[model samples]
Target: MTTRVATETFPMPDGSLGARLTMTAGRANSLEPGLLGDLASALDEAEAQDTSAILICGGRNFSSGGDVRAFHRASLDGEAVAYANAVVPRLQAIVGRLIAMPRLVVVAARGAVTGGSAGLLFAADLAVLAPDAFVQPYYAKVGFAPDGGWTALLPERIGAGRTLEWLQSDRRLDASALCDAGLATAVSDTPEMTAARLAAEGEIGTRLATKALVWDEARRARINARLEAETAAFLERIVQPDTALGMSRFIERIGS
Candidate 1:
């Protein structure tokens, strides 16, 4: 997995900067540890540059969720407990950085955004999905609970009842539907254009100042506490017999 940060400068005299970071993988840029480290480095640079806004997306699918192959390996190797301890907490911390970033964070999703990717979408201040893009919480289908702050963030965008239904089922939602549900700000023809539009809509000075204030107040300590709880619950689901059963059933259903 590789995380490449691209900096595109607009003619904004307002001193606000914007960047787009693409987390890429060899095949499916599943959320591997090295990928996460690369992302953290990119975020550090973005923060240092004092970017007014940041966009997170992928080359193809925003992510196929976590590397299923990695999960499968970990389970078979009996490393689930150790892997969960090391990875889940780091994931939660990275997500914390995202949520607490001073500027508005936009997710430009172009394809099927599932699993942990879905959780990252929830961390966004705004999300722009391609018209044909699909998004869903696919954890339960894979025999796991929600992670990537989905439990904490989903209900904030969609109603609690709806969030529950989505989490419990294997339904897929298109970009337009996500926009209608307030999970996404709009649907774009392309992720690049979406990033450009968001950049154009802002004056650097004002965007930066406003974003800082928003992050400060909006991300109270309670939010972090909730995020930690969410991660813990998600990890617990990994070893549950029901989760294993659900995963097997899902795999068979999908003919995978």
Candidate 2:
């Protein structure tokens, strides 16, 4: 009821239920102020319903990250700071929630996952990427400091040294590379089905218990603290003239 699409409940391995949330709004599933909060609320709904696993299927594309075109417009209007203020905190909350979510969190990544991108994609218990899917970081090119857990959750998933080097370079992490880096759990033509099948393999209660132990309050606190740090740096950079210029050029380069 909270999302653009209906929540489809599925069968989990232990005969409990699972929920599937499909995102479909804006081009390439671009992030919107309302949509982000709605999705987060949808997760709340699923959790309230006691769903053991939740599958997020991003329609067409996983996401083009935050709406750069919108950001570009905000820059032109000198309201980029306000726009970012509106967007980032909500996004950060969802990413943090996923980090310590008791029920399994899964993302079905289909097209491009770019920009500071969806930290939730990386934050998920499992990300099943479509074979042709790719994730790229455009923060350097856009002159934006990484938000959405680029520096936070990612280093936790990959590694600190590698994350730094990777961020500095211009590269696309294709599904294969994503798997090899341990960012994605698997790559398949049908990512939703893949996620569903994976979700059906374990005893939900026991798995959730282990999740609680591993993603403990201490770990959750660390992740939240790091996310807050990213938010601070991001707000500082997004208001700068250089980042406004970068946003302009990047949007023109992409012809959007």
Candidate 3:
């Protein structure tokens, strides 16, 4: 229950330890620069620890994605492009690290996990969701290019065609749909506990090796390259004439 780096150690079934990184950004965890920095630090600590797994969960709504309202404001001020440049790289880097981490990475999310934040679920070795939770991509809705592996890594879970279809329209994938699409390991009311329990299973060495084999060096390289492409796309799209209007409309629609 510690908030400092949000690293709470859990004893695993095979007598090893695990680290849980809790997202405590209250009321729809918005991915601000500071929050992203904190998440990067937590991942830093988790990577350095001698643990078998990392469980990422918590926050009222696991995350409402990026601070779109703030992004909208910055757009009006002509700083949206710069803001996207600063934030997209850091967020994508975190996703890269999750994919390359030497141990298991597990995510348990509730409520809204949208935009680039959904990459956490995509990059995880296992992801559990609360039944009522949903995953969405608002890029088309907000006229932003996809970031956070919505293109690069998500296709690895649900395929490219589905990823394209989902992004081009207004739709949210509920937990059951996510599980069916192979984007989630399971759905549960107690997603945090479910994820922690799954993370605690299996031997540490075996789990680590399994993760490495699946997320091998070549695959990691490809993902990183795609993430860079996503970053570039996001920066370009955020500064376009359509983005300000899109953001304003979406912001008013969501009442965020």
Candidate 4:
């Protein structure tokens, strides 16, 4: 409904189908609920009409995570429960949609992905992180446990021990390290060249059809399972001291 959730479908310079999330706010293109729903609809449309794989990219800095300004405003009124009930479910739905998208979903990560954005990258089928790109999941850094299916999806990609380390460390993961940790498919020194090549391969009908049949259903189910599993973990963690401390430290660190 809101034009803020813009979807532009155009042929890539190399002839692939590309989907650009068109709202730019600061270095982080933080998505609102409307934008997330619009993205899901756009993907569904593209899935029905275009057999070409979809490329998800952003305006400037990919995505910097949850709109902390929005979150903070909600928290300011001492209505923490209201904020959690409203925001977290929408975030989870977005994660589910990203995971269930029935095409070869590729992410072109140019800069930083934090919060829910990082979770989306983890669920993507193929992700190419630019050499300078970084990733941070800020849930633990805040006063909450992981949401957006992060608990389930992160462990699958980076393993439980390492996932715990990454979350607990409150550090940023550069593109190369992400690739090495198995979180990303590749790290692209030349993002343009890599994106171009992927576009070429993506435009092929055979690839899309093959992916739709082989990977879509299976991956979606896996992601759904992960979401449920992670939600439980998150609910439990939210009541723990460690999670509260982690969140407090993250909030203070970010503010100062």
Candidate 5:
């Protein structure tokens, strides 16, 4: 197993809290199980501090989603089902927490954000992407259905029809397309700095109030249900012959 680094939290100058994901090695910050636990703990610490806003920043690629190579290895070891069942639920829980957070949430991402990592864009109240950043829905390519709230939250941003089309196309969405589709608040050369400035300048009370008005318990419940269904379906599909073949090919490509 790869060594896991905890999420680091820093006090921002503007009275907000900043959280940086420290797990950037291997497959562009892939979502390892330990990283997920660190993320959840970091969020809890941020809330405990009563920070006015929360800023999440990542490495060069923000995240490349779950580690496909790890999945392939697990499959070869005959542990794919157990791996998916353990990881997907934790991913869903983290996504749920992000959606239900009381304070403002902001994300600054660069490089390729795909798979489960792309779901973070939708859960965030505001997201800033670097000019070179791209979002890719990689589930279809891997022969797994979307999970981590992608199916539920993406449609709210880009509409059901467009989201379905985009998912099926298996294409990467550039910064401009993400901004135009309402998934990104802005596309900037310095996305992390821009996100910090925006969080500092915005009125905390108003932003929190607006979020409260827009997001309610019932909607959250629906999202949770959808996440559960997606996770279950993905676990079932990933063990099939086609998905196994697809995963093996992906591992080969990455290895080469």
Candidate 6:
């Protein structure tokens, strides 16, 4: 498989190390099977270098979530369950690692960010949202349950009742609305530039300490449990006839 993520390092003005992870493969920067390994490799490099901050960005959109086309194809091949089992665990592990990272991590989001990609935004210590950025709770629309720590992270950011309502309604939230709801750190026309600047300028030691304090052992344990449950639910749902129908409708809608 081709590598979807690109990592690079740059020296900060203050002599701190900076790293970037860019998602390069797939039209919508869709998360695929090897993405976790790619991200882990970047994280490993950052950690080894004692990087002060890491910025994650994507081409066009931050991410459109999982590869629905891939899922549909797998469904037809009677391999959807196998695909899910392979990818979902890796996603869980990566999210866990992000939360546990000892340095600052930020997301620079633009265009459509949905499903598992939206869940990834939650793992970031901060997120910079472009003016054109939007978030979609895409699982229900695709007949899959939430994954990538969505169950554990979103409620805390937006409140449980509101999160539940949003998931069921499948509402799309724009950058302004997300920032208003406290889910996004800032809204800017130049989100990537802003995120990169922040990553370079922010107080690294304080940010690392804050991250460590916020995502403690108990929180990590809870997130792990939720991820496991989400994977189980998703595997069950993906193979269902209704899920296939939903996915088909989604594809047709997009095609039309």
- The local lDDT score (0 to 100) that residue 196 gets in candidate 4 is 40
Clashing pairs in 3: none
Tens-digit per-residue lDDT, 1-256, candidate 1: 4244344434334556677787776545667776766777888888888776787878667777766556656766777767666566666777777777776677888887887667778778778888768987777667776777776766666768998888787689898888788888887788667666776575656765775665565564656787789777867887777866676676567564
Cα lDDT tens digits for candidate 2, 117-172: 55868788888999889988888889778888988888877789888887899488
- On the 0 to 100 scale, the lDDT of residue 93 in model 3 is 95
Candidate lDDT values, in order: 0.72, 0.83, 0.85, 0.65, 0.80, 0.83
lDDT of 6 by residue, 1-256 (tens): 5677888887776788788889886658777877766877778888999888888888788888788888899999999999888778877777777788787888998899988777778888888999999988787878987887778677766788988888889999999998888878898888888988877775677778888888898988887788788889889899999999989999998882
Instruction: Please report the candidate that would top lDDT against the real structure.
Output: 3
The digit string of per-residue lDDT tens for model 3 on 124-213 reads 999999978898898888888998999889887778898889998858999999999888899998999999988877677888898899
Off by over 4 Å in 6: none
- Per-residue C-alpha lDDT of model 4 across residues 1-256, encoded as one tens digit per residue: 3454455665654454666444444436775655565666766667766535566776557787666555555555554445555556666776776655555667777887877678778767677878889987766556566777667677766678988887788788899888887767777865534654675554456655765665467766886776766655655555556654565566677673
- Position 119, candidate 3: lDDT: 89
List residue ranges in candidate 1 displaced over 4 A: 1-13, 204-219, 249-256
Please identify model 3 stretches exceeding 4 Å from their true place. 1-5
- RMSD (Å) per prediction: 2.6, 1.6, 1.9, 3.8, 2.3, 1.6
Candidate 5, residue 182: how far the Cα is off, in Å: 0.5
Report lDDT (Cα) of residue 48, candidate 2: 93
Q: What is the lDDT of residue 237 in candidate 1?
A: 80
Model 3 root mean square deviation, Cα atoms: 1.9
Better of 2 and 4 by TM-score: 2
